[model samples]
Target: MNLPPMIAALRHHKAAVTLIALQVALTCAIVCNAIFLIASHAQRLHVSSGIEDDALVWARSSGLRRGDGADARARADLDALRHLPGVTAVAQVNTLPLMGNDWSADLGVTAGDAQPAVNGAALFLGTPSFLGTLGVRLVEGRDFHADEYVDYSPFDDTPAPPTAIVTRQLAAHLWPGQPALGQRVYIGAGSSQGALVVGVVADVARSAISGGTSDHDVLLLPVRTVAGPYALRVDPTHRDEVLRTLPAALIAQDADRIVTDREAFVDTVHRYFHDDRAMVWLLVTVVGSLLLVTALGILGLSSYWVHQRRRHIGVRRALGATRRSILTYFLAENMLVVGLGLAIGTCVAMWLNHWLGERYEVPRLPLSWLGIGALLLWAIGLVAVFGPARRAAAQPPMWVIRQ
Candidate 1:
């Protein structure tokens, strides 16, 4: 329990102690940031698309050739899929969540303003039944009526419809603390022509998952486009059977067009976030490895010190130092080294986090993680040194003195 003697003993082995402390410091810094990265990736992978992922399937088709009537063919294709066994709902959609292809537009509160209110928002152009097909619930206002649905084409010169429904997230961004329903939001920058926000849906994610607040930023327009992707909702129990036969059914309706990229909504999400999942596991592996190496460093140094100071320990035991005292001395010494490392590592962790935040837009690391990391490393140090400390304590004073 005495301080001066332990301090003097540590001073004699300053180089080894400093090396171990530095190892612990690096471990703390890297592990903390790695954990943050892993958590971020996991959050991204688990983000809600706000759709009935298991019950839905999506497929893309090339537009009809010159001889084929694209609109008529598309309608027939949808009708055929709708009649398929176990298919409940179908809608022509421009984009689906986590597809990586996004239709975005800048929103402005005032018409003809050079600056817009929100720079980027996911735009979904579909029929009145689009929300129903995706199973997105309406939190406020009502769905678009059949009369409000407009036939529009992306390849044509027609502008976007004047009526729109928005996600709750977009509504909040456009009009904070106010009812988003019955409000008008300008569509294009510097254009007074805007769409009235007729409805607010619970939540719908964008096509691309950016892992930001904008993930749920969506603007839905009741504009029917025949030449786009199609989403179908099927009975969950019959999803696999429906998925297999649905493609042939669509193609049967339109032999001229190709039904490509058919996939379940859940599968699409998984494929989209594949890299994110991999990154999470990779960072977890790195954290585990770093902690293992740090523990090994502490164990190696403690064992070496015990071996080198066996005679010194025997003399202290002869001078009435109890086994518990010897063990406590070793543990206390390891704690002092670990504490110094933790102090330095905390600063290093913050600095590293700041750099990552600036470069990668990651959020600042929380102080709680620092505390957790420090505690984890402290426990590791104690456990790593315990074996050596026990060996030192069990050394017979007379046997070592005679040797």
Candidate 2:
């Protein structure tokens, strides 16, 4: 339990001790941040799209010959898609969730306000069957009536419709304590008139995932539009057949229009988050490898120390140092080294987190994660040094003196 001798003993091998401490420090810092990133990515990947992803498929068509009545062609395409076997509902939508394209509007409580109350809520334009097609549950209010539907075009300079549907998250954000229905929120930067929140859906994720609570912030407008793409919900048992046949059906409706980007909704989501999934696994692998290397480093250092101090251990054993005392001494020595490394690692982890937050928009490392990382390293250090300590404790004083 004496500190002077152990501190003096460590001083003899300061270079090795310092190197191992630095290695442990580096491992601790990276593992903490890596784990945070992995969790973030995992949460992102698992975010709810708030739709019938399994039964949904979307297709896009471009290269349409101008003056071929593009709007009429879009309507015909929708009709054809709807009539196809296994099709439940189809709609022309401006954007689908997780497709990486977002049409957002600045919303204000009052009309013509200079600053927005909620910024970057996704704007979705679709037909009256939009909710039905996407299978989004209505939590409050009512869906857009067929009479309220408007024909919209991206090229049109008209203002947005006066009636809109909002996600529950956006509704809560816009009106925290009040009923969201009948609440009017203005859109755009200069618009004086606002849209009434006629409906509130359970949830709808934004097109691009964000760090804030705005990930589920969305507003829906009942407008039949061909500016983006078409989404159709079909029988899950026939999803593949529908996907395979729908493109040819649309092409038949208009050969001039080129069919592009046909895939199931779930597949599209998977494709969008493929890189995030890879990063999660990659970070996991790095964390595992780093911890293993740190454990081995601790084991190697403790083993070397045991060999170097064999005679010293024998002398201590002769002077009434019990086996338990020898074991406790090595464990205490490792605790000191690990404690120093953890202290350095905590600071380095924070600094690295600050850099990551600024450069890559990652969240700050939580203090709790640092504590967990420290505890994990401490356990690793103890386990790694146990065997070497046991051997040191079993050294026979008589045998060492004869040698």
Candidate 3:
């Protein structure tokens, strides 16, 4: 298409053109980054905790005081919960996924106060039914034998757990190519307390997301003690019923216990990711609002330009510029304007990502998203100008003579 006339017209309207171009530039830059952030939030929300979250529920209490009576009450409470309708498995647990980061320890291969081979693996001390209730699949080896499960005690003389189950990520981190099963690893970076790797599970998330592979590096020890919050596996359909009524039942069953908090495991996951969900919606709103404003700006400018240049368009039609050519002219003009904005915006987007990365450690927005954003803006600009372009092209030859 011919460019000289369009260039001359743009020069005559330099201030308006510059203003709209700047708007497009900012929109392009923001949209790219906003989309990238939305995607990041989405990924975080969907990251697997590797537990059967849907079938689980946990109830915390002012119960489970440490003593034989407390232990008997805890066991009785477990029995009461298990016999309740729809409960498939039950265990007393210190930590649960999306619950909180209650404890973490490092494990060393050499086993004598040497530097830990794996850092920040969350420790789980649950009953014999812990794996069954948590619903983590064993990828290799076996669950702790019934005899292997021990009562949890702060004063136990055992140096370390006799057996442990590890996540696949943790296994790979410590042993690399070697099998993690049957490998003896130290419990802490400072102690020679040794534990045997009897089982390897696919994944079980740490109590908290640490934004690293350490989030998957969990160590499960078989400690058969009833205390603290209890993890229950039930029919998914029955989870709500269990969550709602179990607390009341448990409270009524014993005078020593009082149910403090009750929640479905899936609901806990949602609550844990509440900030990510909010950010996703916020970015979506910002992107939607900016695109709406940009489209309206293009539409308004094209309509006004058509009105001001009426005589010029009629004269062009009289001089034999075809209707198709007139439409193409307006469309091409908008493309050129938006293309300039996109070029400027690409640089701005990169700079914005760099700035964000430095301050927030946000990942760089990919080049592909930049290209996609440019194409989207190009299409929007063409669509916005189409109606005014058609009106300018539709005037009859006699209309020019009358004017």
| TM-score for candidate 1 | 0.93
Which candidate should be chosen as best, given TM-score against the real structure?
2
Candidate 2 residue lDDT tens string, 1-403 = 7899889989998977897789889998999999889988898888888898998999888843335587677788889999989999999888998889998878888877888889878888897698899998999988888877776543456766769889999988889988999998878666687778899998888888875789988989888554777899999998999989987899898777778788899998889899999999999999999999999999998899888888888888899989999999999999988888988998999999999889988897889889889999999999999999998788788785555
lDDT of 1: 0.85
Ranking by lDDT: 2, 1, 3
The candidate with the higher lDDT, 2 or 3, is 2
Q: Candidate 3: lDDT of 364?
A: 76
lDDT string, candidate 3, 298-356, tens digits: 99988987777778888888889999998999899889898889999989999999999
Model 1 lDDT at residue 44: 86
Model 1 misplaced stretches (Cα beyond 4 Å): 64-68, 152-157
Residues 271-362, model 1: lDDT tens digits: 99999988988998899999999999999999998888888889999999999999999999999989999999999999999998999888
Candidate 2 overall lDDT versus native: 0.86
Full candidate order by TM-score, most accurate first: 2, 1, 3
lDDT of each: 0.85, 0.86, 0.84
Q: Which has the greatest lDDT?
A: 2
- Per-model TM-score, in order, reads 0.93, 0.96, 0.88
